[model samples]
Target: MALLDTLHRWAGGFVGLVLALLGLTGAILVHRDAWIMLPHAGDAQIQSTHVLAATTERLMSNPETRPQSVTFANANLGLDRLDFGKGAGAYTEQAGTIVSQWQTQWARPELWLFDLHHHLLSGDTGETIIGIAGVAGLFFVITGTILWWRTRKTFAFRPLPKRLSRPAIVRHHRDLGIVAAPLLVLSLLTGATLVFRPISAVFLGPGAPATIDTALQAPKGPKVALADHLDWRRMIVTARARFPDAELRSLSLPRKESGLVTIRMKRPQEWLPNGRTTLWFAADDGRLIGARDAASLSNVVAAYNILYPLHAAKVGGLGYRLVMTLSGLTLGLLGTLSVWSFWFKRPRPVKVRRGVRP
Candidate 1:
C-alpha cells in the first residue's frame, strides 16, 4: 500500500504538467467553432447540393489556388476550410469567398492549439509522449482511488484546496480525484486509444483492430494520373445522389501515386463529426470506384468509431461540450495541484546539534 502511494506520487510529479497542458488545451479546443472569429464563421450551415457543388467547383477551378482538400461547413461552424498541405490553409465562406488565409499553423491559435493538444508540436514523438502521459494519468486515477479508499470516511468535496498546506492539498486531491475519476477515465482511455490503436481491442474486443484495418484498406488497382479539369460538380452530384441522407463533410485529392478522390459525409445517425460514410472516385475520369456506408460497418468497428466523439465532445451539442469542458478543467486542476503537492510540499529534514545531547 505504501509502495503504491509512493509510486502514484512520483508518477504524478513526473507527468502532471503534461497532463495539465493537454487538459487545458483540450478544454479550449472543445469550443473551437464558437471561439474562431472569422467572417461568416457563425453563419448557419447550408447543405444545398447546388451551393455545395458550385462552391467546390469554384474553389477547385483555379489549380494555383486549389487546396489539396476541403472540409465543408457543419452546423457549428459555417466556414469551409481548405488545406493546401505543408501547414498552409484558408477558411472560406459557404459562398466561396476567402475569409482568412494562413501560411502556417502558427498564424492561427485554433490550428496550433489543435496541433499542440494532439501532437505537442513535435509530431509523432510528441504524440507518443502524450500517450505515455495518458497511461500515467490512468494509473494515477486507479491507484489514487485505491489510496483514497483508506480515508474515504474523511472525504470532503472542495473544488480547490482550502489552504496551500500539504495536508490540505492531499485531502483536496483525494476528494477531487474520486469525484472526477469517471470523467477522467473516459477522457484518458479514449485519448490513449486514439494514439495506440491496439488498445482498442480492450474495449472493442479481440481482432477489432485487424477488422477495422481490413475494412478501411484503400482499393488496389491500376493507378492513373489525375485529370487537369475533373468534373467537381458532377462528382459531388453523384455522391449526393448515392447517399441522399448524408451531409458532405470533406473532399480530398489523391495523394502521391494514388489516383482517387475521396469524399466523406456525415449521416444523422453518425456520432463522428466527420461521418465515415465515404465514396472514392477515380481521379483520371472521375468515375465512381467504391463507397462505404459507415452505418453498415462491423459492430466492433462501429463501436470503435464513437471514441473520438466521446473524447472530443464532437456530438451531443452544447450540453455534452460543457460536460467535457468540466472534465478537462478538473483534470487540469488535479494535475497542477498534484505536481505542486508532490514537489514543493514535501517534508523538510530535521537537523540535530553535533554531540550536544545523547
Candidate 2:
C-alpha cells in the first residue's frame, strides 16, 4: 500500500506537467481540420487522376523543384497538398492551379501543433520522453484506481472544489481520476503502443506494424524519364481497378530515381481513414511492383492495425471525437491539479484551543 501510494505521487508529480500538456494539445489536435486554415480556397474536384496528372506534371516540370509527395484532399479539407524537398510545398486546386506556395511545417499552425504533440519540437529524445510519460500515465490510472478503492465510501464527485483547501483538492483528484480512469487507460495504452512500435510485433506479429518501405530497393536498371513524366492517370486507373471499392487516401511520390510511388487507400470495413491497403508503382513506367491488401493481412497484423484508429478516433465520427476530447481535458485537469496539490498548495493548519490547553 505504501509503495503504491509513493509511486502514485511520484508518477503524477515528476511527469504530470508533461502529460497534462500532451493531453491539452491532443484535445486541440482532434479537431485539427476546424483549426487549420488553408490559404487556397477552391472547390476543385478530383474524381479521376486526369486532373491530378496534369497538375502533377506541371509541378514536376519546374526546373527549380522536384515532386516528393502529393496528398489528396479529403472531405474535411478540400486542398491538395504537394510536398517537394524539406521546407518546400504547395497547395493546389482541382484545376491544378497553384493556390499558395508551401510553407515550412512550423509556419503552418496545424503542423506546428502536430510537431509539439508528437515530439515536443525536440526530435527523437522528445518522443522517447513522451513515450515514458505515456507509461507514467498508465501507472497513474492503475494506482489511482487502486487507492480510490480504499476511500470509496467517502467518494464525492465534483468538477472542482469551491475552496482551494487540501481536502477539497484531494477530493476532486480522487473523484475525477475514478471517473476518467477507463478512457485514460485506453488512450495511454494505444499511444504508448504507437510510440514503442515494437510493442505491436510483440503482441501481434512482425508484419503487424505499419512500417513503410518494406519492399524498397536500389535502382538497378538505366535511368528512365523523370517521375513527373510518368502516366499518373494510368497509375490511378490501375489502383482503382485493383481495389475497386477502396477510397484513395493519399499518394507518396518517389523522392529518388529508385523510389516507388506509393498509394494508400481506405477500403470498406477498415477503421482507419488511411487504410493499410497499399500499392507501390515504379517511378519510371508506373508499373505495379508491390501491393498489400488490408483484407489479406495476417490476423496479428490486422489486430494491431486497430490501435491507430482507436487512439486517433478516426472512425467513430463526431460522437467518438467528443469522447476523446473529454478524455484529454480530464487528463489535463487531473495532472495539473495533482501537481498543484502536491507542491504549491499547503496543508491546512491545525486549530488551537484557548489558553486552557497550554
Candidate 3:
C-alpha cells in the first residue's frame, strides 16, 4: 500500500505538467467549431450532391491552388478546409470560394492548438510521449483510488485547495482524484489506446487490432500518378450513388507510391467526426477501385470506432462537450496541484545551531 502511494506520487510528479497541458488544450479544442469565427462559417451545411460535386470539381481542377487533402464542412461548421501539407492550408466556403489562407499552421490558433494537443508540437516523438503520459495518468487514477480507500471516511468535497499548504493540497488532491476518477479513466484510456493500438486488446480482446487494420486498409491500385485534370465530379457522383445517406467528409490524394485517391464520408449513424466509410479511386483515370461501408465493419472494429467520439466529445452535442470540459478542467487541476504538492511543498529539513545542546 505504501509502495503504491509512493509510486503514484512520483509518477504524477513526473508527468503531471504534460497531462495538465493536454487537459487544458483538450478543453479548448472541444469547442473549436464555435470559436472559429469567419464569414459564412456558421452557414447551414449544404446537403445537395450536385452542389457538393460541383464545388469539389471546381476546387481540385485548378492545379496551381489544389490541396493535398480537403476536409469538407459538416453541420456544425460550414467551411471546408484544405491541407497543402507542411503546415500550409486554407478554409473555403461550400461554393468553392476561399475565405482564408495561411502559409503556416502558426497563422491559425486552431491548427497549432490541435497540433499541440495531439502531437505536443514535436510531431511523432511528441505523440509517443503523450501516449506514455496517458498510461502514467491511468496508473495514477487507478492507484490513487485504491490509496484513497484508507481515508475515504475523511473525504471532503472541495474544488480547490483551501490553502496552498502541503496538507491542504494533499487532502484536496485525494478527494478530487476520487471525484474525477471515472472521467480520468475514460479520457486517459481512450487517448492511450489511440496512440498505442496494442492497448486496445485489453478492452476489445485479442485479434481486434489486426481485424481493424485489415478492415480499414486501403486497396492497392495500379502504379499511375494522379491525372492532371481528373474527373473529380465523376468520382463524387459515384461515391454519392453508392452511399446515398452518407455525407462527404474528406478527400485525400495518394501518398508516396500509392496511386489511390481516397474519399471519406460520414453516415448519419456514425459517431466518428470523419466516418470510416471510404472509397478508393484509381488516380490515373478516377475509376472507382473499391469502397468500404462503415456499417459493414466487424463488430469488434465497429466498437473500436466509437473511441474517438467518446474521447473528443464529438457525438453528444453541447451537453457532452460541457461534460468533457469539466473532465479536462478537473484533470488540469489534479495534475497541476499534484506536481506542486510533490515537489514544491515537500518538508524542509531543520537547521541545527552551531553549539547544539546534548
For lDDT, the strongest prediction is: 3
Residue 298 alpha-carbon offset, candidate 2, angstroms: 1.8
- Stretches > 4 Å off in candidate 1: 354-358
The alpha-carbon lDDT assigned to residue 101 of candidate 2 equals 74
lDDT of 3 by residue, 235-278 (tens): 89999999999989999999987899999999988899999999
Error of 2 at 153 (Å): 1.0
- Count clashing residue pairs per candidate: 0, 1, 0
Model 3 bad stretches (over 4 Å): 351-358
- Which order, best to worst by lDDT? 3, 1, 2
Q: Cα miss at 285, model 3 (Å)?
A: 0.6
Q: Which of candidates 2 and 3 reaches a greater TM-score? A: 3
lDDT for position 65 in model 3: 79
Q: What's the TM-score of every candidate structure?
A: 0.97, 0.85, 0.97
TM-score (C-alpha) between model 3 and the true structure:
0.97
